[model samples]
Structure formats: structure tokens, C-alpha cells
Target: MSAIVSHRLHLPGTSPVHRVPAEVKIVCAVVAVFAVVATPREMFWPFAVYAAGVIVAWRSARIGLRWIAPRLLIELPFVVLAILLPFAAGEPRTTVLGLSLSTTGLYAAWGIIAKGTIGVAISLTVAATTSIRELPGGLSRLHVPAMIVVIVVLMLRYVDVIADEAARMRLARISRGDDPRTIRQIGATARGVGNLFLRSYERGERVHLAMLSRGFTGVITEYGAEPATPRQWVLGIVPAVAAICVCACALVVR
Candidate 1:
């Protein structure tokens, strides 16, 4: 399946990172997230540096801005909230840049904005590049409980089917000139959703029964992951080192 619903997840290149083990991508994302979070909360420069680091890694991994940027919308709410944090704190403080804002609160807001944005971008980049199929195997290899993987696998496989069914039903309504933009249409839409949910529930039961009849195991085995090659290491190290250096600089500056 394509990434971002229909977008191609894999970049077209022979970069070594394209062949890296799935587990490594997961680890890199997690470690990078931690790096962003672990930086001191009082500085902004480190976070900018952190963003640069992730971008560098993305470039090295052969992932383009277009490939990775679609997911930035996910971070918009968080960033907006983070930007408001300083004003919300209500501590008596000095104004910065002609705005009556608290000092520590401003710093706090900056901390969240910078770190949170970096974290989301890094996470999205990993998601953009990594294959969905590899995720199950990576999780299984990393000692994640097999049941968890099983549930994830089931949900991913079925959710799209359920969604298409919902869309088809919606199209049927639209063809009948069911105007959905009014408050009066809300009930109809709710009913449509409820109907879809019921259908999905029944389908899930039938699938489970079929699986049982076929002697399905609770845990599906991963075909297994190839080793994380050196290319992956290089791709990882650029960002990791950049993030660490930026954090160090922030710590020193603070």
C-alpha cells in the first residue's frame, strides 16, 4: 500500500537506507524523539539545530520534502497550543518583542514549540520512509508482544476495507442529492457512520470465525528483518550527532 493513504512511501533511489532493517527505522525515530524531548527546556537554538539534524537525516535517507511533509498537519495543533503556553501561564514578566509575555513562560513556550515540532517532523520523516509491512516484523523482532502485532495487523488490513465501504455508501447518498452540509444532515451522517460501524463489526466477527476455521494462530510470525546495514548507521548518525551537539550547545548556553 502507498504511504499517506495514497502517496508512495518509498523514495525511488538506491540509498543504503532503503534496505535498512525495519527495526532500525523504529529505533531511530524513537531515539530521535527522545533526543528532542531531552533537550533543556529553556533554549530555542538547540531545537532549531535539532530540526536541521532531522532534515539532514531525511536528505541522507533519500526521502524528499514532498515525501515527508504531508504529515506536518498533524503537528499544527500541538504547535499552536505550544505557542500559546507563554500567554497562558499568567506569571508577571518582562515583555519580549513588544508583546506583554512572561519570561519563563515564553521560554517554556519556546521549549515546547521547538521540541514538539522537531519531534513531530522527525517522527513523520521516519513514517514517510519506512514500509508499513516492515513495521510488524520490526515490532515482532523487538520483543513486542505478538498479540499487539496481531491486533495491529488486523486493524490495518481491515480499516481500509471498512473505509471504502463507508465511502461507497456516502457516494450513494450524494448521488441521491443528500446535502450533507446542513445541521439537518448531521443525523443522517451519524446514522451512516453507525451503519458502517455495525457492518464492520459483523465483518470482523465473520473474519475471526473464518480464521479460527483455518486454524489461525493468535500470533502471526514475521518473515523476519534483515540486519540494519552501515548505510542506516550513517543516515542515523548525522542526525543523532547533530541533535546531541545542539543539545549540548543549548545546555552550555543555558
Candidate 2:
């Protein structure tokens, strides 16, 4: 599980950011995202400040823009939605370079893009620093519901498994001369998806039964990492504190 998550997201760093407890990092990331989301979208400078804070975090974690940029592609669909908003949104429109767009939609798009980008960046930072093994303990320490923690842990554990299954299935299809890139293969692709779902469902059932046989309970054991010291918490929380301050100032100035 750790190997799977580490290969996909964790950067395996020795920086102070990596040294901070997972729970502390989780709390800080959540607080920072809340601060960004709470700030008025019209206040653009605050987002910039929030972005700067993320950059500082990256530096502290010894992660580079090059490393983070590729991962940001996961948010491209939201970016597309943001792009469409100004055109498809209701009236109260303005003309830009011969294109009429909604005034409200413009702000909405900015809000989505700005807030969403910062949120993803913050999340990736946390994922890069924190291992999958640390997550259950972190959420447990944060008093997250046991069921929710278990669900999250299970989801993370199986994501790589499901992904590998999909890859193998795809390879099998390709070997059988099914060209997935062509339009005619759309039907095959859809069938492949349906088959994948059924396979995953069966696997889940088998795993659940095995767990029950082994005296499985709904609760997950807490993570083995020691609790964060006061100093560690303070050090880890500085970015969130700064983000909150920025948000407060943005509200005041707005």
C-alpha cells in the first residue's frame, strides 16, 4: 500500500514538511483550503498570496513546480468548465474582444479556477509529504468518523489495484487487436468499463468475506506514528495561520 501510494504521489523527502505529523499536515491543509475558499473571489490578491504560500510549502518540502505541474492536469476538466461559464452563463454580460460574456460568470469562473487550483495544489502537497500508511492514523487523530476513515483507507488501497486491473484489461484488448483510440472501439470501451465494474465488485465481495472470516470489524486500528508535539504542530500550522490571516484581511478590505 505504501509502495503504491508513494510511487503515485509521495515524493519521499527528508524536508521539515515531510517530518511533520500527518494529522498536523492534514489539519493545516484543510484550514488553508477553507481560508482560500472563504475569501471573496473578487479579491484576487488574496489568491495570489495563497498561491505564494503554496510555493513556500513546496520549497519547504523540496518539491518543484516541475513535479507538481503534471499532477495539476487532473483538474483540467474543471478548467474547461470554468472556460465555458462566461459564455454559457446568464445575462448581465460584457463584451471582450467581440465575445459577449456574463459579468457574473466571469467572477464565477475566476473563483472556480483560483480556488480550485489552490485547493488541488494544497492537496497534492499533503499527498506528496504524507504516506498512505500515515493517513488512517492522521484522520483518526483528527477524530474523523471510524467508518469514513476505513472507507478512505480502503479506497486508497484499492485505487492502485483497480488501476492495475484496468491496465491489464487494456493490454489484453490491445493484444486482441482492439484499437481503443478509434471511434468504432467506443462500444468495446464501454463494454470494457462494464466488465471492469463487475470484476471490481466481485473482488470487493471476496475481500469482504475473507475479512469477515478473519474476524474483521468495521474499525481500523489507529496509525502507529506518535502524536505531534506542540512545537511540531505550531511549525506545521504556520501556512494555515497565514492563509487565515490573508482571508481575514481580504474580507476586511473587501
Candidate 3:
């Protein structure tokens, strides 16, 4: 079976951000995220600056608001939780628009929304710029455990395989005059899901055997990845260092 080669989230581009080594991007993203996380929830101004930095990164990557906006839908559930936090959490109550609200909860909710929004934005920016194929090489360069990298590589490769298999099974069921819309037909839908799981498991077994026969090893090695130069590392790390500095300033102000 032909495996999917690219991530659905990856937007192909020739921007300099896209050209930076994947390891650098990973490190930068992680550092920035940590900085965002370290900033006190009460120190709201820093999060705004953090968001502006992310927006700059987006522009540098040639990504636009239109591209980033729809992807933000994935965070809607968390947004809902944030919205409910002021209501559900306990604290000294303050009246807002004649409605009783928790003072502490209001701050907590804002923190969640602000931090979550920036975190998701950063993640989408990275996903938009980085190809799925490059991630394993990046992780490998970070000295991450080989088995973890292999798992990540294989998971990315096989996700589409599982999805395609499920689609084909659904089509087969439809061809057999199975109407999945009826309440009485729920049993068939359940069975189809279970069958799909078993088929995927069997496929995995066969693929493992085939890999072993072909001299497959547990570790995934990428020989073709070019080494990251000192210049690249410097360029890549600047944004993360800047984020850390902003976080430090925010802490000092707090």
C-alpha cells in the first residue's frame, strides 16, 4: 500500500522558516512554549507580546491569518472549558453585567485562554511550515531515544493507511445494502468498527513480518539529512532566546 507522504497540516512553502533545520525548529518551538508556560497568568502583557512574536513568525513563514484561523477550530473544546471556568470555579464573587462571577476564576479563565491560544498558534505555525517526513530526522538529531523516533515515524506513516482502510470498509458495508443511519443498524456500525480494528492489527502484524524479512531494525536512521551548521543553529535559536528574555522580564515585573 502507498503511504501518505505529507501531513495534512503542512503547507508547502519556500520561506526561510521552512528552510531552517527541523531540529532547530523543534528546539525553538519547545523553548518558546516553555517560556509561555513559565510566565505568570497574572502577567498578561507578556502573553500579548508573545502572541505578537508568534504572528511575526507566521509572517516570516509566509503563513496568513486565513490559513491559521480555520486550524484554530481544533482548540474550540478547550476554549469552551476556558469560558466555563469563571462559572464553574469557586472564589469571591464579583458582579459582571449584573451576573455573579468568581474573581479568581475570571483570572484563571483569561490565563487559560491567553496561554492556550498562543500555544496552539505556535503549534499550527510549526506544523504549517514543517513537513511530516522531516520530523523524525529532527528528533533523531536531538538525541531522542531511537525507539521513540521510530514509533513517531511509523505512526505518521500508518495513520493514513488506517484511515484509508476504514474508508474502504465503510464503502464495502454500503455496497452490501447496510444502511447505517437507522437506530436498529447501530449494531452493524459497531461491528464494522471492531472489524476495522482487527484488520488494522492483522495488517500491522504482516507489515512487521515483512519488515523483518527485509532486514528491518528497530532504529530509524536518516542518512540523507544534511548536518545543521553553526549559522543555522544561531539563526534558529534567536527567537527562543528572545522568548526566554521576555518571560524573564515578565517575571521581574511580577
Candidate 4:
């Protein structure tokens, strides 16, 4: 499980960024994102500063652009929506390269793209530096609800299991000459999905039973996580502080 989590997102590194306590990194990432969201959409310079901060973080974490760039494709749906905004939005339009675009929509699109990109970038950077095992402890340290933390941890732990199960199911179907790509096989595909869900539910019940047999308690005990020191907090929070300052300046200038 540790190997899977490490390979999926956490880049193994000994840099200062990776060395910071997970709780500190979590707080910093959240604060920086909040600062970005608070900034006015009309202002563009602040986002550049935010991007620069993310770049510095990436550099510190020794995460290359090649590693992070592909992950940013997760925001493609938002980008598509943003692209349509200028065309579909209401009046107050301006001509751009022979196309009439909504002024408000343009700003909205820019806000979506800039904020989404920066948020995703920051998230990837944090993920690259912090392993999945560290997340529950970090959230717990941050005073998040215990149940919510448990749910997140369990979900992360079992996602790969569910994915592997789905893959195996697909292979079985293909081996039986079931071509899911055909429109005629849509019903079969739906049935396959339902079967997978049932299997997953049964598996979950068995796992829960096993846990109870092993004296499972409601509380999840975190191991190997040390408390963050003041120095670590200060160093980790510098980027977030910079973001907040930029947000404030953007608001003032606006």
C-alpha cells in the first residue's frame, strides 16, 4: 500500500519541502489556495505571483514540470467550460479577432483558468511531497472531524483495490468476447458495473467483519508522525504568506 501510494503521487525526495511536517504542508497548501480564490478576477498580476510561488515550491520539491504537467489535465473539463463562457455569455460583448466575445465572460474565463491551474498545481505539489499515509494524521492534527478523516483515509486506501477489481472485470468480459466499445454492449457494460458494485459492497462487509474481529475501534491511531515545530511552520508557511500579501495588494489596487 505504501509503495502504491508513493508511486501514484508522492515523489520520493529528501528536499526541505518533503522534510516539512505533513500538517504544515497541508495548512500551507490550503491557505495559499484560499488566497488565490480571494483575489479579484480582473487582476492578472497576482496570479503570476501565485504561479511563481508554485514554481518555486515545485523546484524545492524537486518535482519536474514533466511530472506535474500531465496531472494538470484533470482540470480539462473546467478549461472546456471556461472556453465556452465567452461565446455563450450575455451582452457587453467586444470583438476579438473577428469574434464577438462577452467582456464579463472573458474575465470569468480568465478567473476560472488561472485559479483552477494554480489550485491544481499547488495540490499536485503537496501530493508530490506528502504520502497518502501522512494525510489522515495531517488532517487529524488540523482538527478536522475524525469521521471525515477516517472516510478519506479508507477511500484512499481502497481506491486502488476498486480500480484493480474493475480492470479484472473488464478483462473477464473481453475474454468472453464482450466488446464494451460497441453500442450494442451498453447494456452488458451497465450490468457489469452493477455487478462490480455488488462485489465491492460484499467485499467491504467482509473487511468490516474482519476489522471487528480484530478489535477494531472507531479511532484511527496515527504512527510515526512527529509534531511540527515552530521553525518548520514558519518555513512552510512563507509561500502562503506571500500569497496572502498578493491577495491584499490586488484588493487594494482594485
Candidate 5:
């Protein structure tokens, strides 16, 4: 199984953030994301403070930046697209390194950078500190669609399996001396993808039949009743409260 899948699952620990209720952490993450989204891009200071808030979570949860770094490659392209938006947006601002930029473009880029970074940070915090079982249930309670949760759950479960299958296929190709460097090999690569998809589809059907024979009423939901501790209450809401304070200060100062 992938480290991420295991990592998201609550690892027993004494960390403050980890000790917080899964639901509270999820809520905080959501609220923080919204705050990042709502704040104007030019308000760079808030983002700096917001990044501090993330740092606090990272420290509290005991999740290192190293764990979060690799996953960020998944985000780099979107970040690149966000950077490009400044050129495509409203009026041009001064050039950075000889590239003409615009206020609209600059703010656009800032918005993307801020929001995307915050969102990703929040999500990584949740994944790092919370367990898979508690995490999805938290989302379900927050009124996220049960179907979406189910899909996410199944997707997580199967991702590594699919990845391993793909790896095996790649290795087999490499062993066959199939150097896919030329455009001519692109068709073969597409066929490999198509083949992988078909195999996955067939396997899914088999899994579904096996599940049905056992019984699957669709959405899976199960959790214990040990309710979040008062300790969690303090730990969970602290960052959110600090965020509220930042917003309040921003309003008062402006």
C-alpha cells in the first residue's frame, strides 16, 4: 500500500493536532481554505500569517514538510497555470525579469498561488494527522455526498493496486527492449494504456460481483462513540480562532 494511504490513517500519537477530533480538523481545514480563497490576493500579509497558521498545524500535527513535498508535484502544474493567468488577465503590470505582467495578472497569480497553496497545505495536514476511517466519516457528517465519499474511499483503496499493475507493465515493456523514444511508439503507449484500462475495468466488475455476493449497500459508514476530548476541542479550534483573530485585525486595521 502507498505511504499516503497509511499516512492519512490516524497514527497513534501525543501530537496536539493528532489528538484533536477528526471532524474538527476537517472543519478547520475547510474554513482555512475558505479564508484563503476569500482574502484578496494583494493582501499578501494575510497569506504570510496564514502560512504561519499552517506552520502551526504542521508543528502541532508533527507532520514534516518532507512528507508533504513529494505530493506537491501533483500540484505544480496547476500552480504553473495559475502563474500564467497574470498574462492572460486584465491590464499589464510592470515586468518581472522582462516579462510584461498586469495588476489583474499579478493578482490573478497571487490568488492562485495563495489559494492553491493554502488548500494543498490544509489537505496535507488533514491527511497527515487523521486516519482514513475517521477522515471520510468526518466528511460524511459534514454533509459531503455519500456517493462522493464512497468513490473516494474505493479510489484510495485501489490506487496502489492499480499503480503496482502499471509498474509491472512498464517493467515488462522495458525488459522487452521497447524503447519508446520516437513518435512512432506513441500509438503503442496508447494501446498499453487502453489495455490497462480494460483490465482494470474487468477486475472492477469481478470485484463488484464478489462484493454483491457478500452484500454492499453502497455507502460504508462506521465509527466509535468515544466523542472528541476537551483536549481536542482546544487543539482543533486554536488555529481557526487564530485565523479569526487575523481577519478581525485585518478589518480593524484597514
Candidate 6:
């Protein structure tokens, strides 16, 4: 049987970024995000510089804006909040387009949009270059907490399984003459959802029992070869170090 794996966000590529160790890329992504976050909101020019660096990383990874742009929809709720900030946040109002808007609010909104976008861009770059399968291994290598790694790995793996099970149940309902579109059928739909959850829980219990019988251990070890070379480390960390330098410059200017 095929493995129950989710669709990977990672794009296939042969770029240097893709070749970098997943652990190194994960570290770099986190460092870059921290650099963006630590920058003062008023340091506008530094934020622009930071964005340029992220774009360069995207280029290196052979990732185009098309792939990254659509995924940004996940942040739509935050975007809406940011858009409303100038209208609703703090004092010291100024007129813009004949409407009174708070100057501090505008600055705060800019900080939210700018820093959030840069952080998301950095994260997308890392995801684009590294497959889902590698993420757990990377976290383990980085010495992340064991419980967190196991949770992440299991979630990634079984989410697809649960989804598939739900789909099959939905099909069965439809075949049995259940019209889920109408309000009259809403109760049935709710019951189906509950049933799906119960089935998923039972499946999980069976899987757990099977794993225990097979002598499964708590640690999810990676069966692989040697560690990342010095060259990979140098290439992987350059963008992160550059981002840190930009953050330092921003602080200095502030």
C-alpha cells in the first residue's frame, strides 16, 4: 500500500539551496525570520534591504513568485487586520483621502505587513527547497524537543490518511442518497462528520497498537548516510548571516 503522506509544499529543484541540508535550511529560515522581526518598524529602508535579500534567496532556490504568491492567501485574515489598522488603532489622527486616520496606526500597520511578508517569504524559501519528509529528520538533528518532533511528524503523516478516510466516507454518503447541499440534510452532514472523527480515532488506536507490537520506540530515527559537509553549511548559512547583518545595520541606524 502507498504511504499516507500529504502533498509536499517543496518544489523539485537542483539549486544550491535545494542541496543544502534540511537542518541548516531550517536554522537559516528561523534566523532570517528573527532578523525581520527584530527590526524597528520605522527602519523602512532596512526592511526594504531585508526584502531584497529574501528575493535573492528565492532566486537562488529557483522559486518564482507565482508559487509563493498563491500560498500567501493563508495570511489573508492578517492582511485584513492590517488593512483595518489605520482606521481603528491608536491616536494622533491625520486626514488621508479626506478620512481621518491615525499616524501611529499607519506605522504599526506597515510594520505588520512588512515584517510578516518578509518572514513568510523566508519560510516559503525554506519550504520550497526542503521536502516534508526531511523536516522531522532536520528537527531531530537540530536537537529540538523530542515530543514536538514526534507530534509534527505524526501530524504530517496521518493528516493525509485522515483526509482520505473522510473523502471515502463522503462518497459513501453520497451514494446512499444523502444530499449534503440542502439545509434539510445538514443534520446528516453533521452526523457524518462525527462518524468520520470516530473512525479516524479508531484507526489511530489500531495503528498505535500495531506499532507497539513491532517494538516501536519513542524516538523517530532517520536511516541515512553521512552528515552535511562544510560546503553545504557555508552555502546554507550565508543568506541567514546576511539577514542578521541587515538587522544589525537597522538597529545601528535606529
List TM-scores for all candidates, in order. 0.79, 0.94, 0.87, 0.94, 0.85, 0.84
Q: How much is the lDDT of residue 6 in candidate 3?
A: 56
Q: What overall lDDT goes with each candidate model?
A: 0.72, 0.92, 0.86, 0.90, 0.75, 0.82
Tens digit of lDDT per residue, candidate 2, span 1-254? 55886888889989999999999999999999999999999999999988888898899899988989999899999999999999999989999999999999999999999999999999999999998888888898899999999899889888889999999999999999888999999999999999999999999999899888988898776646898999999888988999999999999999
Residue 214, candidate 6: C-alpha displacement in angstroms = 3.2
**Pairs clashing in candidate 6?**
none
User: Model 4: per-residue lDDT, tens digit, 89-142?
Assistant: 999999999999999999999999999999999998988998877887788899
Rank order by TM-score, top first?
4, 2, 3, 5, 6, 1
| Superposed Cα deviation of residue 144, candidate 5 (Å) | 4.1
CA lDDT, candidate 6, residue 247? 88
lDDT of 5 at 17: 71
Stretches > 4 Å off in candidate 3: 1-7, 166-192
**Model 4: what TM-score?**
0.94
Model 6 worst lDDT window (10 residues): 1-10
lDDT of 6 by residue, 1-254 (tens): 11334234668789988888889988888988898899989889988888888788788888888888987676777878988999997789999999999999888889889988888877777777876667777888888998898788777677777877888888888999986788998888899889988988898889889878988887666656346788888877888898889889989978
- Candidate 2, pairs of clashing residues: none
In TM-score terms, candidate 1 sits at: 0.79
Candidate 3 structure quality by residue, lDDT tens digits, 79-127? 8988897898787989999989988889888888888889898888887
Candidate 5 segments whose C-alpha is farther than 4 A from its true place = 1-4, 7-13, 143-145, 221-225, 229-235, 244-254
Q: Candidate 1 or 5, higher lDDT?
A: 5
